[model samples]
Every structure is written in C-alpha cells, then in structure tokens.
Target: MTPSESAAAASNDTRTRRSRLLDRVVGSLWPSMALHRATRLMAGGQAIRAFGLFARAARAGSAEAEYQVGRCYLNGAGVPVSRADGFRWIERAAARGHAEAEWILAALYVDGVAPCCDRQDSSGSPLDLFSFDVAPEPDFAAAEKWARRAAEHGSADGQALLGYVLTFGPKSMRDLEEAQHWYKLSAEAGCPQGAYGYGSSLVQSGDSEGDEVRAADYIRLAAQAGLSPAIYLLGMLTERGWGIERDQSAAVQLYRRAAVIGNRSAQTSWGRALMWGVGVEPDRIEGESWLRRAALAGDADAAALIGDIYAEAGALPPNYAEAAIWYRRAAEAGHAAAARTLGLLYLSGTGVGRDPREAMNWLGIAAEAGDRSAQVDLASLLLNDGASHPGDLAKARDWLERAAASGNLLAASHLGVCLLEGIGMDREERLALQWLHQAAREVVSAQYWYGRALSEGRGIEADPSLGRAWVARAAAAGMADAEAALAEMMVNGRGGPKDHGAALDLFERAAAKGHVGAMYALGMMRDGGFDVASDHAAALRWFEAAAERGHEAAQHIVGHSPQQNVRDDR
Candidate 1:
C-alpha cells in the first residue's frame, strides 16, 4: 500500500472517533434528542444501533431511555437477555417516575417475569401476554404496591391490571368494589380488558336489570375490540336474551368468531350448535373436530359432550369404547354426569371391564355431588350386593332416603319395600304405607305392595274394598304378584262376594304369567273339583309345573300321589 493512503486511513479513523465523542457529549446535555433518534432507529428495525443510542440516553439519566434499555435486555433485542439487569434498569426508571416503567414493573411483580416483547403488534404495543408463562413464585403484595402507584400516575393499563389482581387474588386481598372502581376508570380510558372485567362483574352482581343492560353494552365494546372472552360472553347473553335480544343465529356466529381465536368455551358452544343443528346446519364431523380441539385444551364440558356423542345412537352406531375414553377424561376432571355414566359402563361391562368396586367409587363421587339419578343407582347397587358387604344394606337405605327426598319415585318405591319387609331396618308399617302410597301413584310395583298391605291390615285399618280396587289396578297393569293376590282374594271372598267363575279366570291369567302360587292354586281347584268338573290330568300337570318352580305344597303332592306314577307311565 502507498504510505499516503495509509496515513489518510489513520486520519479518517481519528476523525470518526472525535465525531462520536462529540455526539455523546451533546447527547448527555440533550437526552430527549437521543431518545427520539433511538425510537426512529427501533421503528426502522435497526435494533443494535437503537440500543446504543438508548444506552447513551440512559447514561444521561433519561428515565424513558432507561426503560427502553431494560426492555431491550429483557427481550434480547440486540442485547443478551438478563432478567436481573433488566429488573434493575426498570426499577431505576420506575423510581424516576416513568409511568410506563411503573406499569411494566407492576406486571413483572404480578407475573414474576417480563412480558414477551415478541408478542407485540406492528405498532410495538404489547398484546395479551398476560398468560404466557408462570413464575416459580409470585409476589402479589409487591405487585399490588407497584400497580397502585402506576394507577395513581394515570396509567390505564395499570388500572386494569390492578382491577384484575384485586378481583382474582387471595381472599384477604380481594376487594370487588375497589376492583370495580379501577375497572371503570380503565374502561373509560379505553382499555378492553377493563371493559370485559367490569361487564362480567356487573352481570354477576345480581343488581337491577339496568345494570345487566349496562354490562351488555360494556361487553359489546370489548367484543368489538376483539377480546375473545368478551365475544364468548356476549354470545351467551344474546342466546339467553339476558340484557340482549335473543338471536340464536347471531349467537352462533359470535361463538364461531371467538372459537376461531382459541376460546375454549366458545369452541365448545360452537361445536354443540353445529352438532345439534341449533341455529346452524348439522355437521357432525366438523362439530366433533371443534370439540376435540377444546377437549385437548382441557375443557371438561367439551370432553363430556364428546363422550355423549359417541355413546348416543344417532346417525352412526354407538361407540362405547370411545365414549368410555372421553367419559373417563371428563370424570377425572370432576364432571358429575361423566362420572355417573362411566360408573354405569363399568357396572355393565359395556365398554370397560365389569368392576363393581370401580362402579361404586365413580357412582359415589357423582352421588356426593348431588346427582339424584346417581344416588338411586348407587343405592340399588348396594342393595343388590348387600349380602356380600357388611353395612351395605344400611348405606343403601340412607342413599335411597336421600334420593326419595329429592322426589325420585323409584327410590321411594324401593325405600318403602325395604321398610315394609324389614330388609334393612326395623319395620315401620305407617311410614312404609305412606311411602308406598306416594310412589304407587306412578310406580306399579309400589301399587302392588301397598294394596297387599291394606288387605292384610298391616299398617292401617283393613279397607278390603279399597284394597281390592288397588290390587285390581295393579293387576290390570300386568303385575304378576297383584294378579295372584287378587285371584286369592276373589276365591276366599275376603274383599268381595265369592265368584268361582271369576276366580277361575283370574287364576288362569296369573298362571299364564308364570306365577308359582297361581299354578298351585289352579292345581288345588282342579283336584278338589271346586271350580270345574274334576280333571285329574290337568291337576297333575299344574302340580308338576308348580313343583318345578319350587312350590313346596305342589312338590309334596306331585311326589306322593299315586296318580303321578300313572302319569309318568303314560
């Protein structure tokens, strides 16, 4: 190289160093100018040059520049990510009364981490970075302290965050009224999250209808701003006509909008609408796709609904195995109906192995959650297996009583039978009769038992005529026991005048239903020639039929009669 050229290069290097030194001196005296240039550079995507200017302004004690440097360090924007250094710089800016720094500091304390800068929009404003990550530990007290300071400094985002903390924090720190106050301020300042929070609070307040209307308006504002939760809630209000005109089609559209943005509740609602053709054309495949997405996102209700779709016999054959899988997922998530259905599946071995213990465990969970049907089913299981498990009879009675008190007729009938027969407890004739009568209005078995009790004068004064009428009602409904009992009453004239022809007819009807007692009675009438001309062959056949069914008297007659030997020879 020529010597002159090398000298010129050294001189240019000296000039460039002198120029940079002069610029730094000027920037120290006028930090705002440096900040402006840094912002411009950042807008142009020159992150390294922007960071250099921001650091120079921060060295000159500019609070905004200090915040910018902290954000760059935290977000790794042309700087190595360092949470400690970022926090220190942000604290310095916050202490110097930078409103944005105070807001960010409060958010850091609330979440125990910096908000992700990569989630910002094109305008460089943070989006909903509230739920992205969790901290090893959170400092709610510190968060509240900084948030209050930021809100007092008139930061709208700070006000909204303060409202959120107060509304959902620990019980001792929660203050709904205070939260509402901040939420209103933030909402008035154009914060969509604040609008949504305030609207939700008003909806749940149970105040006047006017408050609900106001809530709907606020929620609409948030929804227009593209808040997914607000959109979902507005859809619910629209569908139910709560503070809004009912429009199912519009509600479904709203659900679709929110669902597309990843709102799990909205996805579930939209899936249900599509599957059931509610305000939409039925599309089971598409509906199931949406539901699966929600279920994968940990939506218990969506999982249960998917289970129902598989279990129900519809356009496609029921898939019990798939239903059981979804039901188990929902059940593990505390879905009461899913637990009950899973219990039934286990009990019946429909999709899983038959496991009485597992069925009882799941059914007990549902019953304890106040499921009336589960209570009755659990009681029935206990009663059926009472002999195998000690104390099961008492537990069954308790469960039946609980279900009966909740207006379950099947439970009432079972409870009455247990009391009447002293199957689980001491007989309570009056209580048994009362329960039996109550259930008899709808339960055929209860009708038969109540009628038998009245005829025997077991609980109340014998009303033979009323007993005969009740038994007739049960018999007409095809109760085998009632038919046999009514026929005996007719033959003995216990309730009405004796009628041999009617008694014979009743006996034949009851015998056709496989009633062993009726078979024995028919054999007796034929053998004694009490109702018709003596027919020894028919009597022997009836006795044999009854004997095969374990009727003791019929067995004795068939075994000892010489006519039996003649019949066998024939």
Candidate 2:
C-alpha cells in the first residue's frame, strides 16, 4: 500500500491526526467502484504515492469513493471533465445517502453544470428532479443538507469540514452552535484536524482558552499519524515542559516526524535536537544539513541556529569561516544572533574582515531587538571597555544590567569584574560575588574570581577548601590564572597536596591548551629537572616561550639573552 493509503488504513491507529482527512484512507474505506475511480483520477492514477489505495477504493465501488470520483470530474482531474457524468456519479452517491456527494451535487446544480438528470440509488430508490441554481440558495441548502447527513452518519472528516465551512466560509452560511457541535463530534471521534482546529478555535483571540488534556490527546494522536502542524506544537510544549514534563525523547520524535513530512518549523527543531544530542544521538552533518534545508525554506529560527552553529560553539563546535557564512545568511534572514555575530566577526576580524562600523551596525540591530548578549557587547563597545571597542561605562552598564537580569553568564561575569575593580562604578561586593558565582558555573575566569572571593572571604564566608576546588576545576579547564594557582598550591601543599610531579603534569597539559602560566611552570620544571633530564637548553627554550608572553618570572629568568638563560654554569 502507498504511504497515504497505509495512513488511512491505519486510522484506527488511534495515533493519527492531521488538517485534512487523507484521500488514501477514504479510498480504502469506500464501497463504490465508480467513486473510487474518481478518487483515483484525482490522484492522477500514478503509481507514485497514494495510488494503490485509490485503485482499491475504485474496485470497491464505495459511496465516498464515488463522491471523490465526482469531485475529480468537476475539477478535471487526469482527464477532461464531463459535467453530465460528474452529476451522474454525484447523484448516484447522494441517492445512496452519501453526504459529501449530496454536497457536490448541490454545487453542480447551483452552478447549472448538469441538467435534467435523474437520481437513482443502489437500492433502486428514485427522487424527483428539481431545477437548482447558485442564485436560488439550493447550493447552500444542499451543502447544509448533505453536511447534516454526513455529520449525522458519524463521518468525522465530514463533521470537521462542515464545522470549518460553517464557521469561516460565508457569513450568510455561518452557524456557531452547529459548527461547535460538528467540531465536538469530530474531536470525540478522533479526528486529528478536528481536534486541533477546535482547540485552537476555542482559545484563539483570548486568554481564556486551552484544554491541555484534550488538546494534548488529539495532538498526540495526530502527531503519531504524521501530522506536521500538530507535531510541531506538541514538540514545543514537551520541550518546554509546558503542558507535559520535559520529554526530550517525545519532542525529538515529533520534530522528526513533522520534519520528514515537510513541516518547515519541525525541520529546524529536529535539526536542533540532533545537533545538540538533546533527545537523539548527536549528528552534526545531518543536523547541519537539515538546518540548512529549513533555512532555505525561509525559517528564520533555523537560519539563526545555523548561524549560531557556525559562529559560536555549540553541539557541532565552532568554525569561524562556517560561522561567518551562517551568520551572514541569518542576518540576511533577519535573525538577531546572526546580526550580532556579524558584528562580532567584523570587530574581531574573525572569518570576515574587521570593520568596526559594520560591527556597530549589526550590534545596533541586535541591541534594538533586545538581545541581552548583544546589548551587553554593544553597550561595552559604547563604553569602550571590551575587545578594543570604544568605552561608555554607563551605556555598557545598562546593557549589562539587562543581560545580568536575564541570566547571561558573560554579562554577569563582566559585571562582577566591573564591581570588583571599581571601574566606572562604585564597589558592590555582594552583587559582584553573586554575578561571579553565576558566571562561574560555566566560565573558567569567573570560577577563578569566585575562588578568589572564597579565599578572601569577599562578600562571602571564607572557605579555603572550596576555593581550592574551584581553582582546580578552572586549572583543569586550562585557565592561566587557575593553572598558576593550582601549581602554586601543589608546590606549597596549601590546598590539599604538595606533588611536584602532579603539578608538572598539569602545567604541561595547561600549556598545551595555551595557558601562559602553564608555560612558565614548564619553564620552572625544566629549570629544576623535575620530570626530565637537567637540560639547560630546554629550560632556556621553555623560558623563552613564557617570556614571549611577557611573563615577569620567565623574563627575569631569561634576562637579556636566550643563550645566557641556557646556564653555562650547568
């Protein structure tokens, strides 16, 4: 069976939902051969997708199938329309009490497409022919008549469609209570489209809306049936723990299904999940590919995500050139992150040529958009405090305050530094410590600050062990100051131990990761021959590396010449 047909045949799956009743399912359940042929014709009789079911329905001779066939004829599907034949099939189905057929026949009669047609039923029942015209209200009358019949016959799709037509189509055709009744019936009958439409309609335009339980059930059912819209919403709710517990797994599944079904929003969301390894295995290539697809599809958020992945470190890590590309794309797509990153690239000469003016422009856009990070960076630039950007302390503080309030770690860290140094502001130990602690959770430099605070009892109780632990973590993360702190502790047995061997190993690792203190430590290590041969040449080289960074200790050791530092005394 075609996927569409399979979808219909699996209606009892109790998991399917969608905006419309699937034609394949209609074909499978139909009992009129002629009508089945019509539905098949509507699908162009191709063996591509959704074809097998139409063929089966055509073979079945079902009423609904016949109605579909009639629709195809009216719309000229796969062949030239035969108005007479269209009316014939519709009339035949309507006589069999097919509501959809009745509606179609009514439209044909109203449009005067068919005339003088005799109506006959499968059971040989006959009806008197009447002149119908769009001007005479018979079309609306017949539409309502057939809708009532279909709805009364427990056709969920009919009920939902009728409710939609009644609620939104023509003002003269509107019926609030009737629309509500049909929608309710369809929802109860497990119609995916009906449930979502009803739920949205109920809560639309007002705060007094949303039956989470009812909506969740229908959304879940429809999501299972591969309904993209419902799946996207459900994924959002689940991810945020809004109407359900934060279920990364469920969210990922919803996103995947919707994305596969060509839901633009879902594509971005699913890509993000894959990229972040939130509820699925991290797949950078796939994630990036999907995100690109979404961005191409005009999804702003997806564009922004691609930009973020490229410019800043995330699930796939960072690549300045790739990030530059993504950031530019996103900026063009009107994403704040993209704009900010563009500015950053320009200011820092990262992947893009440095242009402080362009950077200012992009940052200005993001700052106006209320991006806390952008605000902080831009404000700092205005105040001339960070990364060679001009300084404006007051303006910078304003942005910093916003960022700090919104829990931006970098902003908080910068704020703490400002307070501690009394730079462009008065000292505020308590607030500075709080911000430092917050930033310390993920920032090595911030951790060092907090560690220093703990060690000095600044704005908090002194705890040497706590301080040491924080410093150790920062050292492991390769922070220069932290590495120096740990090395000193190891050498002096201040925190926990005095292991020169351990200290030397840490120094080497940190040096490899680009910690300047670690380089100096390595120089000292070579000078003392702690773990290697007493090689004065190597000692001089190590000292030279640290000296390049203007390390005072290394400079003093190296003195005026590399040869002199090699120690002929050895």
Question: Candidate 2 has what TM-score?
Answer: 0.47
Q: Which structure among the candidates has the greatest lDDT?
A: 1
lDDT of 2 by residue, 1-570 (tens): 899988877885643343123545554565353344444544565422233343355357656656655655566764356666567767778878886676455445445454544665578665333334333333455556666676777778768767766776568988766787787788888888677656545433224324555556666666666667878988877887654678889889888988998999999988988887988999978998999999998887888787676666655567887777767777877788778878998999988788898898899888888777889788767654443432455667878887888888888888887786665677888888889989999988889888877777887788867888888888878787787777767876775767887787777777877777778877777776464446677777888888888899888888865577466655
Q: Rate the local accuracy (lDDT) of all candidates.
A: 0.87, 0.72
| Clash totals, every prediction | 0, 21
Give candidate 2 regions above 4 Å deviation.
1-299, 305-326, 344-350, 354-360, 376-392, 456-465, 493-498, 524-535, 559-562, 565-570
Instruction: Evaluate residue 252 in candidate 2 and report its C-alpha lDDT on the 0 to 100 scale.
Output: 90
lDDT of 1 by residue, 119-184 (tens): 776787866444345443567777888888888999988898899889887889999999999989
How far out, in Å, is residue 517 in model 2? 3.7
- Per-candidate TM vs. native? 0.74, 0.47
